[model samples]
Target: MYDIVIVGAGPAGATLARLIGSKYKVLLIDKRDMENENPKKIKNKCCGGLLAPDAQKMIAQLGLGIPKDILVNPQLFAVRTLDLNNNLERLYQRFYFNMDRDKFDQWLISIIPNEVDKRLNAYFKSFTEISGGYEISYIYNGQEILAKTKIIVGADGASSKIRKLIAEDISSPEKYISIQEWYECTEYTPYFTAIFDEEISDFYSWVIPKDNYLLLGSALRPREDTWNKYNLLKAKLIKLGFTFENKFKTEGAYINRPKRGSQLYGGKDNIALVGEAAGAISPSSAEGISYALKSSLYLAQSLEEGIDGFLDRYNQRIKGIRLNLLIKNLKSPAMYNPFLRQLAMKSGLQSIR
Candidate 1:
C-alpha cells in the first residue's frame, strides 16, 4: 500500500510527488502516455503562461527549480485600453514573465524522483473505501490494476473525477472561455502587451513574447456571440501592427469563475483535492499554476501535522487567496479605465525617478 496516490501528472501531481516521495511511498498517475514527447499531443491549454513574480518566489520555496532559458523576460508593460476612437491608454505597475507551459510542466515533472511510481497512460476508474485507506482501480496497458492507498489526491484538471468522488455537494460555475494560438516568428519584440476593449464588456486579448515566437490569446464570456467577438478582436489586432507570418491553429479551454461551496477535502478520512481540480484559479487572471504548487506545499505540510490541522490550514489559506483575488477582480474594470490607465502609467514613470 502506498502513502499517497495522486491523479493527473500535471504540475500539481508532479510537484507533490517530488515533495513527499522521499518520505512516503507515492504513486502518480496520468492518462497521457509517458513516452509522448511531442508537445502538440497534449491537450491545447489556453494560457499565455505568464508567471508572476510571486509565483517565482513560491517555486524557490518549494525547491522546484525551473531552468533560466525557459523563462522569457519581457519588458515591463501594462493593459492598454482600445477606446471607441481607437485611442490607446496604458495601465502600468503590473510586471510578469512569459513562459512556455509545456516546457514548464515537463521541467517540473523531471525533478521528481524515479522511485515515485509514475503510471502514465493510466486512467483512474474509481475508488472504494477500504478498512485502513482506499482501493483505487486504474487501467494500465490495457489491463486493470488495483492499488491500495492511504491518501488520494485529485490533481486532475478542472473536470476532476476524484473531485466527483469526494465532494458530493459541490457545484462548478461556467464562466469565460480563453482561446489561444501560437505563431512562429522570424523576428519578435521583447515587450508583453495586452489589448482590451472596454465596450466588449469583459473581453480582452494578449500578445505574450517568447524566445522566437508570440503567444496570442483572447478571453470572453461563453456565448454564441463569443466567436464573433474574437473575430472582431483578431481583425483589430491585425490592423494595429500585429502580424503572424507563420501561423498556427487556434486552441481553446474554459475557465471557471468565482464559484462557491466546492469542497477541497473529501472528509476526515484520507482524500484531498488540489489544483484546478479544486477550482483554485483566479477568476479574472485565470492564474492557477502558482496556486497548484502552493496547494501541494500546503497539503504536504498538513500531512506532516495531522488530518485536522491539514484541513484547517487548507481552508484558511485558500479562502484568503480566493477572497483577495475576487476583490481585486471586482475592482479591475475601473482600474483599467482610460483615465485611470493614463494616470497609472504616468505615476509609474514618475516613481522610476
Candidate 2:
C-alpha cells in the first residue's frame, strides 16, 4: 500500500511529490507519459506556455531555475489588447517568458524522487473506500490495475476525475472549453495578443508566438456551436491583418473559470486537491502556473510537517490564494467589460505609446 496516490504529474503533483516523495511512499500517476526512462507518446496541457510575472515569483521562491531547453523563441515583452467590437487596440507593457509547455512539465516530473512510483498511459478509472484507506483503479495498457493508498491527492487539472469521485463537498467552478491551435508562422508576431470579441467568447482568447509557430487559443463557453465561435474569432483576427499559413496541430481541454472565492477548496477528509483542480487558476487572466505551484507548496508543507492532518492545515494555508483569486475577479470587469475596456483603452492608462 502506498501512503499517497497523486493522480496527476503536472506542476502541482510534481512539486508535491518532489517535496514529500522522500518522506512518504508516493505513487504519482498521470495520463501523460512524462517519465524519462521509458519512451512513449507525449501529452501536455493546452496552455499558452507563457509564464506570467506571478509564476516567475513562485519559481524564484521554490529556488527552481528553468533550463535553457525549455525556453522558446520570441520572449514576450508586451500585451496587445484588441477589442474587436470597439475596433480599438492597445499595447501594455508586460514581461512573460515564452517556454515549451510540454518540456516544462517534463522538467517538473524529472525532479521527483526515484523512490516514488510513476505510472504513465494510465487513465484513472474509479476508486473505492477501503477500511484503512482507498483502493484506486486505473487502466494501464487497456488493462485495469488496482492499488491501495492511505490518501489520494487530486493534482489533476480543471477536468479532474479525482475531484468528481471525491466524497467531500467540492466547490465547483464554471467550466469552459479551451481550444488552442498551432499555426505555421508566415511572419514574426512579437507581442502576446489578447483578443476580446463578445461574438467569440465572453471570457477571452489569446495569440502567442512560439518557435516557428504561433499558438492561438481561446476560452469559450461549452456548447454545440463552440467551434463556430472559435471560427468567428479566427475571422476577426484575420481582419486585423493576422496571417496563418497552415494549421499544424490543435489541442483542447476543459478549463475552470472560478468566479467566487467560495468556488475554491483544498479538499476535505482523505481526499485532497491542489492546482486547477482546486479552482486555483486566475478568474481574470486564467494564468494557473503560479497558483498551481503555490497550492501544491501549501499542501506539501501541511503533509511534510504532519501538521494537524494535512487537510485542515492545507485548507487554512490556501486562504490567501483564494482571496487573491477573488481580487482578480474584482479586477475582471475592467478588463472584460467592453465599455469599461474601451474607456480604459481610450484613456491609455497603462498602455505603451
Candidate 3:
C-alpha cells in the first residue's frame, strides 16, 4: 500500500508531491497527459497566466527560483485598470510575472522524485474506507484501477471529487465559470489590463498579452446568459481601443470564490484537501496560485510531523491561510462595487502616476 495518494497534479498537487514524495510512498495522479497530450485538443486551464506578488512570496519561501525558460515575452510593469461604467482608467504598478502556465505546472511536476509513482491520463472515480486506509478507484487507459493508501490528498481544482466526500457540512463557495479566449496579434500589447463592468460580471475580466497573442478572460456566474456576457465583454474591449484579431483558442473551467473562512473545507479522517479543492482561493481577485502553493506547503509540513493525526495538524495549519482569504473577501466589495471603484479610480489612490 502506498503511504499517500495525491489527486490532481496542478500547482498544489505537484508542490505537495515535490516536497514529501521522497519521504513517503506516494502516488501522484493527474487526468491530463500534459507531456504527451496535444494542448489544443484538451481543455486547458483558463487563467491569465500571470503570477501575483503573493505567489512570488510563496515561491521564495520554498527557496526556489523560476526558470527563465518558463517566462513569456514583455515582462509587465503596470496594470491598467479600466472602469467601463465611468470612463475612468488608472495604472497600478505590478511585480507580477508573465509566464507559460502549462510549462510552469510541468516544471513543478518534473521536480518530483522518481520514487513517486507519477500517473498521467488517470481519471479519479471514488474512494472507500478500508481497514488500514482508503481504497481508491480510478479509470486509467480504459480500465478501472484500484489502490490502497494510508492517506489521501485532494489537490484537485474547484470541483473536487474528494472534497465532495468529506465537506458535506460546508457549502462550497460561489462558483463561477471562467472563460478565456486567445487571439492572434500582429504586435505585442505593452500592458496588462483589468476591466470592471458589472453589466458583464460581478467578479472581473482581464486582458493579458503574451508573445504573439492576447488573452481575454473573465469569471462569470454559470448560467444560460454566461456566453452573452462574455461576448459583450469582447465588444466592450473593442470600444476601449483594444484590437481583436483572428481568434485562436478558447478555454472554460470552474473556479470557486469563497467569501468567508467557514467556506474553506480542510478535510476529515485520513483525507486532506488542499488548494482550490478546499476553497482556499481569493474571493476579491479570484487569484489561487498563492493559496494553492501556501496550502500545499502547509500540508507538507503537517505530513512531515507524522501520518498519525495528520488531518488535525493540516487543518490547524490551514487556519492562518484561510484567515487571510477571508480578509480578501472584505476588500472585494470596494473593487466589485461600481460606485466605489469609480471613486477609488478618480481619487487616484495607489494608482501609479
Candidate 4:
C-alpha cells in the first residue's frame, strides 16, 4: 500500500508529489500522456497560459524555476482593458508570462521525483474505503487496476472524479464553460487584452498575445448558446481591429470558480481535496495557478506535520485566502457597470499620477 495516492498529474498533483514523494510512497495518476507518439493526441489544458506575478513568486518559494524553453512570451508587461459597453479602452501595466499550457504542465510533471510512481493514460474510475486505507480503481490500457493508500489526494481538475467520491457534504463547485480560439500572431504584441462585455459573459473574455500566436477566449456560465456568445466575442475582436493571420483551431473546457462558504481544503475519512477540486480558483480573475500551487503546498506542509487532523489545519490555513477571494468576488459584478468602470479607471490614473 502506498502512503498517498494522488489522482491527477497536473500542476497540483505534480507539485504535491514533488514535495512529499521523497518521504512517502506516492502514486500519481493522470489521463494525460506527456510522451504520446502523436503530439496532437496530448491533453489540451484549454487555458490562456498566463502566469501572474503572484504565481511566479510562489514557484520561486517552492525552489523551482520555469525553464526558458517553456516560455512562449516572457516580456508580457501590460494588460489592455476594453469596456465594450461604454466603448472605452484603458491600458494597465502588469507583469505576466505567457506559456504553452501543455509544456508548462509537462515541466511540472518532469520535476517530480523519479521514485514516485507515475501512471499515465490511466482513467480513475472509483474510490472505496477499505479496512485501514482507501482503495482506488482505475483503467489502464483497457485493463482494470486497484491500488490502496493510507491517504488520498484529489488534485484533479474542475470535473474531479475523486471529489465526487470523497466529498459528501460539499456539492459540486461552480463551473464555467471556457472556449478559446487560436490564431497565428503575425505581429508580436507585448501585452494581453481583457474584454469586459456583459452582453456576452457575466465575467469577462480575453485576448492574449504570445510570441507566435494569439488566443481569444471567454468563459460563460454553462449556457446552451456558448457558440453564439463566442461568435459575438469574435465580432467584437474584429471591431477592435484584431487581425488573425491563419486561424488555427478552437477548443473548450470547464473551469471551476470559488464559491462563498465552499470548503476549499477539507476531507472526510482520510481523503483530502486540493487545487481546483477544492474550488481554489479566484472568483474575480479566474486565475488558478497561484492558488493551485499554494493549496498543494499547504496540504503538503500540513501532512508533513501529521496526517491526523490534517484537513482541519489545512482548512484553517486557507480561511484568509478564501475570505480575500470572496470579497473580490462580491465586487467583481460592479466592475461591469460603465460608470463604475470609468470611475475606477479615473481613480487608478489619478493614483498613478
Off by over 4 Å in 2: 36-40, 167-169
Provide the TM-score for each candidate, comma-separated.
Answer: 0.83, 0.96, 0.97, 0.94
Per-residue lDDT over 1-353 for candidate 2, one digit per residue giving the tens place of the 0 to 100 score: 99899999899999999988999999988999776445336875789999999999999999999998999989989999999879999999999999999889999988889999999768888889999889999988888999999899999899888888773465699899999999998578789999998888889999999989988899999985999989888887887788866899899999999998888977767889999999899989889999999999999898876635889888889999978987999999998999998898999998899
Better of 1 and 2 by TM-score: 2
lDDT of each: 0.71, 0.89, 0.90, 0.83
Residue by residue across 82-132, what tens digits does model 4's lDDT show?
888877777888888788888888889888888899998898888888998
**Which residue pairs collide in model 2, if any?**
none
Error of 4 at 164 (Å): 2.0
lDDT of 4 at 188: 72
Q: What are the C-alpha RMSDs, in order, of all predicted structures?
A: 3.6, 1.6, 1.3, 2.0
Give one digit per residue, the lDDT tens place, for model 1 in 216-245.
777777775887877777777788787866
What C-alpha lDDT, on a 0 to 100 scale, does residue 40 get in candidate 3? Answer: 63
Candidate 3, run of 10 with poorest lDDT: 34-43
TM-score of predicted structure 3: 0.97
Q: Which ten residues in a row have the lowest lDDT in candidate 2?
A: 35-44
Candidate 3 deviation (Cα RMSD): 1.3
Measured with C-alpha atoms, the lDDT of residue 97 in candidate 4 is 79
Estimate candidate 1's alpha-carbon lDDT, on a 0 to 1 scale: 0.71
